[model samples]
Target: MNTKLPKLEPITSEWMFKFINNYELQESLFKSYESPINIHSLDAFSRNIKEYQEILATYNFNSKIFFARKANKFQNLITAAVANGIGVDTASYEELKQCIDLQVSSDKLISTAAIKSRKLLELAIKNKVLLVIDNQDELDQVAQIAREYNIKAKIGIRISGFYYEGNKLLSRFGFDIDDIENLLQNYFTEANEHLFNIEGFHFHLDGYSTSQRGESIHQTLDLIENLNSSKTSFKFIDIGGGILMNYLRHQNEWNLFKTELQDAVLENREPLTYNNDGLGYTNRNGQIEGDLATYPYYNENSKASFLKEILDTTNDSSKAVYQRLEQLNIELRLEPGRSLLNQVGITAARVAHRKVDARGNHLIGLEMNMSQMKSSSADFLLDPFVSYNNPIKEAEPVEVYFTGAYCLERDILLKRKIELPQLPEIGDTIIFVNTAGYMMHFFETEAHLFKRAQNLSVLGRKEHYTFDDFKTE
Candidate 1:
C-alpha cells in the first residue's frame, strides 16, 4: 500500500538560508573533506547571549545567566561566554578546569555535577567556584575538603519539589524537601558553619513547564522562610535551565503528522519503511498506549521569548516570580544549555551516493553517521534542508531516507524519510540546522576510525571558516 508521510518544516532565520545557499562557500568548505563537517556561527552565539542578557535586564532584581558548558564541548563558545563576562556552569573536572584555564573568573563558575570527584571538589574550593551540593554524603566530603584547606565550601543546596504527572521527584540530582531541616541543623552549626557556606538553593527538571518552574521557586522560597532561624544565609534561587527550543515552524502540521503515523501504523500500511518498528506504540485491550519519545519540536514559547513568560508567570495563588524574588531580595541564576545554543550551528554532510532499497524505497547515503547528530532524544524530528552546489529542476519530487556509512543496519542518520525537491547527486550537501545545542557533540563518536566530523567556526560575515580541532580534545 502507498503511505503518505508527514512533512515537517524547520524554523530558521533568513541569514541561515543565505549562508547555507552560498554556493561558493559550500564549494570551498567541501573541497577537501569527503565526510561531514559542523559549521558554527560565532555571530549567532553572540546574539543569543546578548538576547538572554537583555531579558534578564528587564527585571528589577539581580540576575545571572550561566551558559551550561556540558551542552556543547566547543571551547570557543566557552571563550565567548568569558569574553562577554557571563558565568559558565560546568559538570565535570575537565569542564571546570578548562573554564578556569581559559581565564574565566573563579566567581563566574558553578559546578552542579551529580557525582564530583575529590580532586574536582578541591579545585572548586581553591578557585572559589560555587558548588551545588547534591546529597548529604557529597556535602560531608566537601566539608572535609574545605577543612583540610582551611576555607569554607561555597555551596547551594539542590532541592527537588513535586515533579510532573503527580509523580515522585523525577530527578536524582537534588535534596528532598524533608531533608532540609536535618541538613541545616547538621551542617550549619556554630562549629561547622565556618567549614561550609550555604549560599542558596537550586532545582532542575527535564521538561520546560513554566508553571512547574514557578512552583519550584515557590517551594524553595518556603524552604528558605522555614530556615530563617538557622545561621545559613541564602542569596540566590537557581532554577536550573529547561528553556524550550522550537525546531519546527508549524505545530498543526506536526500534530497532523503524528496522527497520520499512528493511523498508518495501525492500518498496517506498506511502502513506508521506518527504522525500529515504525514509531513503536503499545497495544492493550484494543487500546493504543505508549509514550513515543518525541521532542517539543514545535513549541509556541521558544528561547527568544520564553524567559519573559517564565518571569511573568503567576502561581495558582497569583504570585508573580519577579515579585517573589524582589520580596526575598534573592538573585535569579539560570544555567541554560540547549536554549542558549539554539541557532548557533549546523551540521553538513556530502551525499556519497543514492540508490533504491530492496523494498523500492529510495535511499540517499551520506558520509556521516547517526552518532554525529544523536542526542538523548530518541529521534530528531525536524526535516534537514538540502543545499546543492549545482541546482537541478526535476519533473517530480523524490522521497528518500538518508543513511550513513556505519556497517550496522540501524545506522540511519534521519529516522524520518524526507522528500527532496529533486534527486540528490554525489557531492550535494545535506544540512541539519540549529544543532549547536547538545545535538552537535553529546553522543558523537570516532567509531570505525571515521575520525569524527571536524568543527569549523564561520567567522566575520561568513566569509572565512577555520577548523578548530583543539576545542574538542
Candidate 2:
C-alpha cells in the first residue's frame, strides 16, 4: 500500500525482464508420464546443474555437482538427480534414509551438517557416505569411528573464512584455516589412518553473489597451496550453493519490466506486448496477448555470466597466487539450494478471509505464511503474478497487503506493496511466483489458528502435479 498502483502494462522497450514462468511450463511437460503427478520437471534443475558445472570447468576447476537435498527434498528431484549421476548432499536421518529409498548409491551421497545427532552420524557412517565432520570434538569422534570400523573415511574439512560483507562468521560450524592446517599436519589423519582420509575442503555461504564465493575460494586456494607444501593431499572444494536463479537475475537486470509487471499483476494484464512468437509482456491497453517471444535471459547469458565472470577472475594470477597448488587438480562442487527449482514450481492457497484495516486497507489473509519462501529474503525481491497464465477476467488493480494464517503480524510473506488482479475473491487460489525453491515448505508448523499448505510439483507438458508429498501429519 506504500506505492500507488500504476497503469500496469508491459514495457514497450528493449529486453530487461525475461519472465521464466515455470508453473505454466510444467503443466505442459507433465503430459508424457502416467504418474506425472509422482514426478516433477527437474529439467530446470538439470539445466542449472550442467551450466554451473561448465562455468567452473571454464576456470579449469574440476566439477562435482552435489544436489543439496535440504532445499526441497522432493523424491522427484532426488530420483532425477541420481539417475542423472549427480551427487547428493544430505543433512539428516530422513535424508539419509531417503537416499537409500531412492536407491541413490552411497558413493553419490555426502553427509554434511556442522552439527548432527549421533544416530544420524552413525547412520551416515554405516551407509558409507562421505562425512563432513565439523568441530574438533566431532573430528575426534569421527576419527574414533574410523578406527572402530577399520574403514578409511573420505572427509572434507570445512573452513570458516571471514565474510567479505564484513559480518563476523562466529557460527560454531567450521575450523579456522590455522586449526585445519594444524590438525591436518599434526593429528587428524595420523590419529586414525583407518578413519580420516581428508580429501578436500568445504564451506557453506549465504546468497548468490559471486564475489563472496570467489573470496572464500581465493583463501581456500592459498590454504590448499600451503597445506600441500607442508603435507601432500587435498582434492575437492565444496562451495556451498546460494547462487542466484536465472529468473532472479532477469528481474534484477530488467528492473523496468518487473516494475511494470509488478503494476500489471494487480491490474490483471500482460507484462509485455509481443508479436511473431516473442514473449509478450506489457503493452498498450487492449493489445493482443499472443505471439510473445519466449523471454530469453538464461541461454544468452544474464546472471549466469556474472557467476561465470566471478569464477573467471580466479585466472588473474595476482589473485590466485598459489599457482602450483591450483595444478593439484580439484573439482569445484556447488550445493545450490534455490536456482535449481526456479519457476518449475508454485505454492497454491485459498484465501482465508478479507478484511479492511483502519486506513481503509483491504488485507487478504492466505492459509500459508511467507517465511516459507527463501528468495524473498532481506534482499530477495519477488515479482509474483497469478500463475494461471490465462487471460485475466478482472482488469482493475487490487492494492492490498497480505497476511499469513499465523496471528503474528510478523508472519507476513510479502512485505512490499504488491499489485494483484483487482478484488481477488475468497477461496480463489493465489500463486506466489518463483517459489519453487525454499518457499513451498520450510517453516510449516501447526502453530496458532492457521493450517499448513499443501505442496505439489509439476511434471512435463501435461501440467500434472504430485500432491501429498508435503501434507502435514
Winning model by TM-score = 1
lDDT of 1 by residue, 222-257 (tens): 778778655567899998888998888898988876
Worst 10 residues of 2 by lDDT: 10-19
Count steric clashes of candidate 1: 0
**Model 1, residue 85: C-alpha shift (Å):** 3.3
Best by lDDT: 1
Poorest lDDT segment (10 consecutive residues) of candidate 1: 464-473
lDDT of 1: 0.79
Q: How displaced is residue 252 in candidate 1, in Å?
A: 2.2
Candidate 2: list runs displaced more than 4 Å: 1-3, 6-40, 56-61, 162-171, 189-191, 207-209, 230-232, 246-303, 319-326, 370-380, 387-395, 448-452, 462-473
